[model samples]
Structure formats: C-alpha cells, structure tokens
Target: MFELLKQPWHWAVSGTLIGLIVPLLLILGNKKFGISSSFRHICASCFPGNVKFFKYEWKKEIWNLFFVGGIIIGAFIATVFLTDPANSIRIAPDTAGILNSYGITDFSSLMPVQLFNWSNLFSIKGLVFFVIGGFLVGFGTRYAGGCTSGHSIMGLANLQKASLIATLFFMAGGFFSTNILIPLIFKYLQ
Candidate 1:
C-alpha cells in the first residue's frame, strides 16, 4: 500500500476522481467547488464587520476552508515525504530543449529554480511574474465570478454559459502567455 501510494497514478485515475466530484457535490446539495471561494469564506469569517462582501454566513462554507487546508498539507507531505528526488521534475527532451533556449537550465525541482527561487523574487522579472501576475490572477478570478477550477469543473457541470466563455478565455490567455509573453520576457528581461 505504501509503495502504491508512492508511485504515480495514471492520469485517468485522477480524471475519474475529479469527474466523480461534480455528482457527489450535487447530491450533497453543494453548488460551488473551488479554492478561490475558500478565500472569501476566510475573509467573511475573520472580518465580518469590515466589508459588505464579508457579511455573509461564512460558516456554511467552512468545509471548503478545510478542503483547501488539506490540499496545502497534502502537498507538503507529497513533496517532503513521498517524492523520490530522481523523479521530481521530468520533462520531455524537446520541452527541455525549448526551456534551455529560454535560459531555464535547472529542472531539479517542480519549477525552474532560475525563475522561482527566493533570489529571483527580488529581481524585475520576478516582480512582474509573481507580484503583478498574482494581482492580475486575483482580480481576474473575482471579475470572472470564479476561478478556473470553479468554472471549468462545477459551473460547466451545471451547464453555465459563463463558465464556457471563461474557460475559453482561460485557454486563450494561457496560450498567449506561453507562446508570446514568456518568450518576450526571456528574450528581453533575461
């Protein structure tokens, strides 16, 4: 069982599990599912008197906070205990070659140390990528009414048209960032 837990499961396994979540949540009378809403719940619980947005009965969604907490704890356990260093960050040769062209040589960790390390956080590239990018993501998620997981998974499962539009834009934005923005950043900034 321990060895099985340590091994990587097939993509289908995760897909099936995620597929089941929609129906399970529906049966349980829960309409929403995502990490973003947990932030709202936390704010509502902590700052009930501060903002009109945070005046709701956050206790109703307390389970979502626990769910997000579990995700963080699980990630820590996976990275620190379960991960085999040799198999940490596997990339295809072509993908590695492409990244190498962008001055991203290190692939020893989940993300490129050249990009994600603490030292890079103080640099101009990191300021744009992390600080500004993070704000945009937060603003986008709020403006869109939900995050990618909420829209792509739960909202689409409920046949919401807005989710479909949001998902399409999300894909397009990802493509633009990967193909256009990232190369520009690497070429000019690095």
Candidate 2:
C-alpha cells in the first residue's frame, strides 16, 4: 500500500495541493505554512519554560496543531487503505535497480521491513555517514536561514529575494550533489 505512494505523479500532485493550501492558510489567517514550525510547536508542548527552543505563544494556535495532527493521520490512512495491489510491479526501474544493488532483489521481500535494525543502520560506516550528512543538512538550513521548502515555496510565493537566491542555490546544489558527488561517493564505498 505504501509502495503506490512512491510514484512521482503522486508526489507531484500532493506537492501542488500543498502549494494550493499554503495560499489558503495565508489568506485565512496570514500564516506562512511550513513543516519546521511544527517542530517548534512540539518543542513548546514538552518544555514550556525553556525560552530558547520552546519560545512561542503556541497556546493560541491549538487549532493549527490539530490540523497538523490530521495531516499525519490522513497519511497513515492513505498508506494502509489506499495502496494499490499492483504497486510492487509499478515500481520504477531505477528504484528497483537501486534496491537490488542493496541486496533487496525481490520487491515482495521489501515489505514489513524492520525499523530499528541497529546493526545495519548504526554500523560504524553508517553512523559516520549519517553524522556527516546530518551535519551538512543542518549547516545548509542554518546558512540559508530556513529549509528549502520554506524559502522556495512560501518565501518565493511572497516575492522574497533572499528566498529566490537561496532556492536557486538549493536547486543547483541538489543537482550537483545527486548527479555527481553522490554517485562518486557510492561507487567508492561499493
């Protein structure tokens, strides 16, 4: 069921709908909708006294929090109930080949995969790579003053110049890293 959602068109449609909703959110309440803000909301709930991280008048936006919860619940329902039976066969050749390279040769073998497989996920090699990758992502987000979607979708929609430059750099950086650096690094590791 979750496999059907791996489709490109499915993501494209969802992204377009999200973009549509951003304007509605702005018009209805003048809120710049984003995912990062949700983290802040959660933090405020856990540590209301901490002024550094949990610094928000989050109590006023309880309804917005409910909307976020709805999004999470809706995603679970879509994954479990709306997934197509032919999803495994509908997988892209590139994705299938990538999975095969990782020793996951069978599409049927992919499902019911373990989540906390620490030996594989937290191996010496895996952990170091994750630390470096996570650091780079955090650095990028900080250096840009916000995440890609926040600056690109919401910022550009409001005609913010900083966001435009950041969005272009983000796109260029993604293209170079994915098309060049990622393959080089993966080949060396293999």
lDDT of 1 by residue, 84-148 (tens): 77666568999899899988899888788788868879898889889988888877887788887
Which parts of model 2 are misplaced by more than 4 Å? Answer: 1-12, 43-67, 89-119, 128-139, 188-190
> How many clashing pairs in candidate 2?
0
Indicate the residue-level lDDT of 44 in model 1.
83
Per-candidate TM-scores read 0.86, 0.65
* Alpha-carbon local distance difference test for all models: 0.83, 0.67
- Whole-model lDDT for model 2 versus the true structure? 0.67
Which pairs of residues collide in candidate 1? none
Best by TM-score: 1
